[model samples]
Target: MGFINDLAAKFTFRPGRGRKEQNGLLAEELAALAKKIERLAREQYKANILAEQSISMIHEQRAGLREEIRAGAIRELAMGLAGDLLPIIDGILACLDFAGENESLRAGLRSVLDRAEVALARYGITPIEALGGKFNPSLHNAVEVVEVSDLPPEIVLKEITRGYRLGEAVIRYSEVAVSKSQTGTVWPGME
Candidate 1:
């Protein structure tokens, strides 16, 4: 009887003590789980911030690439148009050279040249100043060298074929005759 009563007491559920102990264990487990969840959330937030930064960088690069492509296409189109107009101008100039002494023909050719210049100006195409200017490799191609005692060496004495440019871009280089001094050095102003 005594052993049975002791066993019953040991196995018996005391609501106050048993429930409090179980609740404390449950609370500790819940706190641990909550801390783990919070840590994961913080890590995920940092990852998201890094991802957004990467995406922004990619977008900037893409925009810059698009701008470069657009500029290149514009340059190409301008060059193509200039290519078509240059030969016509050259032919007209040649005719003008041959039409000398015929006042009427010279006047007609002069009017045509004026009109062509105006049309080119409207499209941002302008003749590169070559004659009397210092010869630049970028804008001038020296086909002939003339030894001159009066003028500075490397000076452009004459433009054989005119150069044209659209905005800062040179479409064609001027074929020019440059002066060479007796000493064989470039002009003073030229580097």
Candidate 2:
């Protein structure tokens, strides 16, 4: 009977005792809910940080691609412009070549050529000097060599083809006739 009574007491509730027990259960449930809320807040903060980082990385990649595209376009335009100017340079050189055999028209052709050169100069183009100057393998290609007693050796005696430059870049090398030493001894350096 005592065992039976203890069992009954475990299931049975006194009025005040039952109310306090129910309130304690509610408090425990609320504490558990607060812990879940804190975990959700931490997760939200991490997701926001990751999203910001991803946005920043994408922005940097887009900027780099844009800069590369701009540079490539600029390079292509510059190359095309240079190709177009090559034909003009060739035409001027051809005129100079034909002028050599015609003495009567040479002066008039020279005036026209000079005007063209001046116009090119206005746009940053110029001809390289070859005749009677020191031999520079960088800007002059020797097609023939002549031995002259009066002229200094290694001097440019004639220009076969005119060479040109744009800014500091050489477009063509001048085909020239360079002089060799006549006496078989190296000529003294020129003054």
Candidate 3:
């Protein structure tokens, strides 16, 4: 009986040692679980930041696209308006030339010109100064060359037709008479 009891006692687990070992294992497992949770939390934070950045980029792209669309619409509108006004301006200039020395007719023509200028100014349109200025091929179409002793060669002496610009864009180029030196070097396009 004593031998059997001794063997049973040897094989049986003691509460104190078992509880201590179980507690140690539980603590290790809890620590590992805490580390895993912290890692997951950090990953979640990084993912959130990435999502926010993506959203911001999308918003900026959308805004840029909207601005481009608006600018295109404005450009189209300005072109159409300028095209409509060109013929009217030419007619007014013709009338002014034909008014001659009649004071009343000249006054009326000047008033019309003023109104036209106001309308053009509303859309950023303005005339390019050609007469008495240096001839620029980009702004002026040289229709004729006049012999001039006072002015330098290539200087614009007269404007046959006025030129206009809308925000740095030439809507029309001036038909101009350029000065030629007495030497008659034969300006370009003249045989």
Candidate 4:
């Protein structure tokens, strides 16, 4: 009996409501469902666009990191190669000091040295200023201390071999003689 009543209720309509009213209620429900579907589609589209923007940002950051790594590697390689080449360059300079009575040989060697300098110059390699200047532990390596009464202590007396730098970085320190007083104290009238 209970099942029969439930089945009758489903098939029957209200006392006053006709087919038109029932159809109106169904149409309202369909419109609400369609609106919900459209809203959800718009939200999904926005999410996809945000994801694409994030992916591109990540790609740009990765490219920047790669470029930084490459630049660092090249800097290290240039420093190492300069280390090996410096000894040879110093040797050539030493030979030039004793290149007397061989004018042609000396001139040829000078030209070769100049070319080598030009090649390294392309990479921003340059000689450090050492002689007749104040001594700096960062740029100058004190190979010998000269005892003098006239010059101020810590002043560079001589440069034994030239130093080199790449930009602000010291590739090699200048071998130099720094001044010191005979009594191992600060010079008189010198600050």
Candidate 5:
């Protein structure tokens, strides 16, 4: 009789009661839904990880570029300061030239000048060649003209005052005496 009642209940429909088979089916559906949610969560977690890595890479690149720019700016600032100090260097050179050629004094002056020259050379300050070269109106100022037979026309015979330069830019023009050929020299359009 017990077995018959159990079998009857399996085939019978109950209206207002919890059934074992229905509970099992509902639990199975909930478990399947939970697995789907877990899969989606895993995908989202991986995506977030990738995005974080990308952001970190971008930040590192930006930091490297920033450092390069800073280095470049510092180098440019150093060069500009050196350029401003050129005139002061020229003053030092002039002092050395003006001092008399006493051995002890000259030795002391030469030592100081040599050090300054090395520093200036590192910073691109160079002496302009003026004597016995072709006179460039741009770099040499003709304070006087003299007739000479040995030199070519318009050549620099003497540099009255030395000139200094910073790289390609002339800080001061060389004060010079330009030579005119003795025989061929004539006034403009007087030939």
Candidate 6:
């Protein structure tokens, strides 16, 4: 019976408990809930800011990629036009050789060729160095091999037709005559 009475007392509310105290406890619980909600809101705001920054960075990268592609296309077009003009320029040069006695015709041909060269310069097209320089398979295509005793073998003796380049890319390889030493002076420095 004593155990049963103790259990009953635990379940019952004491007479000292008042509505004022219950209201204070409820207010404290509500304040704690409000603090938790504020913290969550601040975290959500920071996440949104980070997401916006990521999106902006992605947009900038995409724009840069587009610019690079456009520039590459322009470069290719200019190179193609320059290649087509080279044959005409070479023909004008060949005419100068035949115009030995005709000074007026030679001068006129030279002027026309000079104007064409100036136009090519606007697009950064330039001729490759070949004559009197060491032969490079990439820049010069050997059209003839001449036997010489003084100069080193593989040296470019003459440029038959001019080669051209746009920056690092070769538009056409120069047709050239390369030298072959007859006396077997293979190493210039050794002598």
Q: Which window of 10 residues has the lowest lDDT sum in candidate 4?
A: 2-11
Residues 30-101 of candidate 2 have per-residue lDDT tens digits of 687689779999999999999999999999999999999986775555445545664665676577677777
Tell me each candidate's TM-score: 0.64, 0.51, 0.66, 0.64, 0.43, 0.64
Off by over 4 Å in 1: 1-33, 147-155, 179-191
The residue pairs in collision within model 4 are none
CA lDDT, candidate 5, residue 94: 68
Q: Which stretches of candidate 2 lie over 4 Å from their true place?
A: 1-104, 183-186, 189-191
lDDT of each: 0.85, 0.76, 0.84, 0.85, 0.76, 0.85
User: Weakest 10 consecutive residues, lDDT, candidate 1?
Assistant: 3-12
Query: Could you tally the backbone clashes for each prediction?
Result: 0, 0, 0, 0, 0, 0
- Preferred candidate (lDDT higher): 2 or 3: 3
**Candidate 6 residues 155-187, lDDT tens each?**
999888988888788888999999988865675
For residues 1-191, could you state the per-residue lDDT of candidate 5 as single tens digits?
67447645655667865688767755776687689779999999999999999999999999999999986775566467556765566566566667776678768877876786677667566668988898998899999999887666788987777676667877668888998879865655446
Q: Model 3: residues >4 Å from true position, as ranges?
A: 1-51, 184-191
Cα RMSD, each candidate:
10.2, 11.0, 11.3, 7.8, 11.9, 10.1
Worst 10 residues of 2 by lDDT: 74-83
Whose TM-score is greatest here?
3
Q: In candidate 1, which residue pairs get closer than 3 Å at backbone N, Cα or C atoms, i.e. clash? A: none
Kindly indicate the candidate among 4 and 5 with the higher TM-score.
4
Per-residue error (Å), model 2, residue 112:
1.5
Clashes of 1: 0
Question: Where does the lowest 10-residue lDDT sum fall in candidate 5?
Answer: 3-12
Candidate 2: clashing pairs of residues = none
